[model samples]
Target: MMLSCKEATRLMSMQMDRELSMGERLQLALHLTACAGCRNFRKQIGFLRTVTRKFGDQIDDS
Candidate 1:
Protein backbone atom coordinates (compact mmCIF):
# COMPACT_ATOMS: atom_id res chain seq x y z
CA MET A 1 0.00 0.00 0.00
CA MET A 2 1.04 3.58 -0.74
CA LEU A 3 1.69 6.07 2.03
CA SER A 4 -0.01 9.42 2.39
CA CYS A 5 2.04 12.63 2.79
CA LYS A 6 1.31 12.70 6.52
CA GLU A 7 2.48 9.14 6.99
CA ALA A 8 5.54 9.69 4.81
CA THR A 9 6.54 12.79 6.77
CA ARG A 10 6.05 11.03 10.08
CA LEU A 11 8.14 8.12 8.91
CA MET A 12 10.86 10.50 7.78
CA SER A 13 11.02 12.07 11.25
CA MET A 14 10.90 8.73 12.98
CA GLN A 15 13.82 7.49 10.90
CA MET A 16 16.11 10.13 12.44
CA ASP A 17 15.34 8.73 15.87
CA ARG A 18 15.38 5.00 15.16
CA GLU A 19 15.87 2.36 12.52
CA LEU A 20 12.92 1.85 10.21
CA SER A 21 11.76 -1.59 9.22
CA MET A 22 12.59 -2.64 5.64
CA GLY A 23 8.92 -2.36 4.69
CA GLU A 24 8.69 1.16 6.10
CA ARG A 25 11.83 2.18 4.25
CA LEU A 26 10.45 0.81 0.98
CA GLN A 27 7.12 2.55 1.42
CA LEU A 28 8.72 5.87 2.30
CA ALA A 29 11.07 5.65 -0.66
CA LEU A 30 8.18 5.01 -3.01
CA HIS A 31 6.23 7.94 -1.64
CA LEU A 32 9.29 10.21 -1.87
CA THR A 33 9.76 9.33 -5.53
CA ALA A 34 6.34 10.83 -6.32
CA CYS A 35 5.96 13.59 -3.72
CA ALA A 36 8.09 16.70 -4.14
CA GLY A 37 6.78 18.34 -0.97
CA CYS A 38 7.69 15.38 1.16
CA ARG A 39 11.05 15.20 -0.53
CA ASN A 40 11.71 18.82 0.31
CA PHE A 41 10.60 18.27 3.85
CA ARG A 42 12.99 15.37 4.15
CA LYS A 43 15.87 17.45 2.85
CA GLN A 44 15.04 20.30 5.18
CA ILE A 45 14.93 18.04 8.19
CA GLY A 46 18.19 16.40 7.21
CA PHE A 47 19.84 19.78 6.87
CA LEU A 48 18.52 20.86 10.24
CA ARG A 49 19.80 17.69 11.85
CA THR A 50 23.24 18.13 10.39
CA VAL A 51 23.39 21.73 11.48
CA THR A 52 22.17 20.91 14.97
CA ARG A 53 24.73 18.17 15.39
CA LYS A 54 27.52 20.44 14.26
CA PHE A 55 26.41 23.15 16.62
CA GLY A 56 26.25 20.73 19.50
CA ASP A 57 29.69 19.44 18.70
CA GLN A 58 31.05 22.98 18.69
CA ILE A 59 29.50 23.60 22.08
CA ASP A 60 30.98 20.41 23.42
CA ASP A 61 34.43 21.45 22.21
CA SER A 62 34.18 24.83 23.89
Candidate 2:
Protein backbone atom coordinates (compact mmCIF):
# COMPACT_ATOMS: atom_id res chain seq x y z
CA MET A 1 0.00 0.00 0.00
CA MET A 2 1.10 3.56 -0.71
CA LEU A 3 1.91 5.69 2.28
CA SER A 4 0.18 8.99 2.90
CA CYS A 5 2.19 12.21 3.31
CA LYS A 6 1.69 12.15 7.09
CA GLU A 7 2.86 8.57 7.26
CA ALA A 8 5.82 9.43 5.09
CA THR A 9 6.62 12.42 7.31
CA ARG A 10 6.61 10.30 10.45
CA LEU A 11 8.80 7.69 8.83
CA MET A 12 11.14 10.45 7.66
CA SER A 13 11.53 11.71 11.22
CA MET A 14 12.25 8.23 12.47
CA GLN A 15 14.76 7.71 9.70
CA MET A 16 16.49 10.96 10.58
CA ASP A 17 16.78 9.88 14.20
CA ARG A 18 18.04 6.43 13.22
CA GLU A 19 15.06 4.90 14.87
CA LEU A 20 13.86 3.00 11.81
CA SER A 21 14.77 -0.58 11.06
CA MET A 22 17.02 -1.17 8.05
CA GLY A 23 14.09 -2.30 5.94
CA GLU A 24 11.98 0.67 6.96
CA ARG A 25 14.78 3.09 6.24
CA LEU A 26 15.31 1.67 2.82
CA GLN A 27 11.63 2.04 2.02
CA LEU A 28 11.56 5.62 3.19
CA ALA A 29 14.68 6.49 1.24
CA LEU A 30 13.13 5.12 -1.91
CA HIS A 31 9.90 7.00 -1.33
CA LEU A 32 11.65 10.28 -0.54
CA THR A 33 13.68 10.17 -3.76
CA ALA A 34 10.57 9.48 -5.80
CA CYS A 35 8.23 12.03 -4.16
CA ALA A 36 9.15 15.69 -4.51
CA GLY A 37 6.88 16.83 -1.69
CA CYS A 38 8.33 14.23 0.64
CA ARG A 39 11.81 15.16 -0.50
CA ASN A 40 11.16 18.81 0.36
CA PHE A 41 9.72 17.72 3.67
CA ARG A 42 12.86 15.74 4.35
CA LYS A 43 14.99 18.76 3.49
CA GLN A 44 12.94 20.93 5.83
CA ILE A 45 13.35 18.37 8.56
CA GLY A 46 17.10 18.41 8.06
CA PHE A 47 17.18 22.20 8.16
CA LEU A 48 15.14 22.16 11.36
CA ARG A 49 17.57 19.72 12.91
CA THR A 50 20.52 21.95 12.03
CA VAL A 51 18.82 25.02 13.47
CA THR A 52 17.83 23.19 16.62
CA ARG A 53 21.25 21.74 17.20
CA LYS A 54 22.88 25.15 16.72
CA PHE A 55 20.48 27.05 18.96
CA GLY A 56 19.94 24.25 21.44
CA ASP A 57 23.48 24.67 22.69
CA GLN A 58 22.84 28.34 23.65
CA ILE A 59 19.53 27.45 25.20
CA ASP A 60 21.21 24.92 27.50
CA ASP A 61 23.72 27.54 28.71
CA SER A 62 21.08 30.05 29.74
Best by lDDT: 1
| Candidate 1: tens digits of C-alpha lDDT, residues 1-62 | 99999999999999999999999999999999999999999999999989988996677644
- Full-model lDDT, candidate 2: 0.82
How close is every model to the real structure, measured as TM-score?
0.82, 0.70
- Would you list the C-alpha lDDT of every candidate in the order shown? 0.95, 0.82
Deviation of model 2 at 31, angstroms: 1.4
TM-score of 2: 0.70
N/CA/C clash count, model 2: 0
Q: What does candidate 2's lDDT look like per residue over 1-52, in tens digits? A: 5667788899988777677888777777777767999999989989998998
Residue 46 accuracy (lDDT) in model 1? 100
Every model: Cα RMSD to truth = 2.6, 2.9
After the best TM-score superposition of candidate 1, give how far the Cα of residue 7 lies from its true spot, in angstroms: 0.5
Q: Count clashes in each candidate, considering only residues at least 3 apart in sequence or on different chains.
A: 0, 0
The TM-score that candidate 1 achieves is 0.82
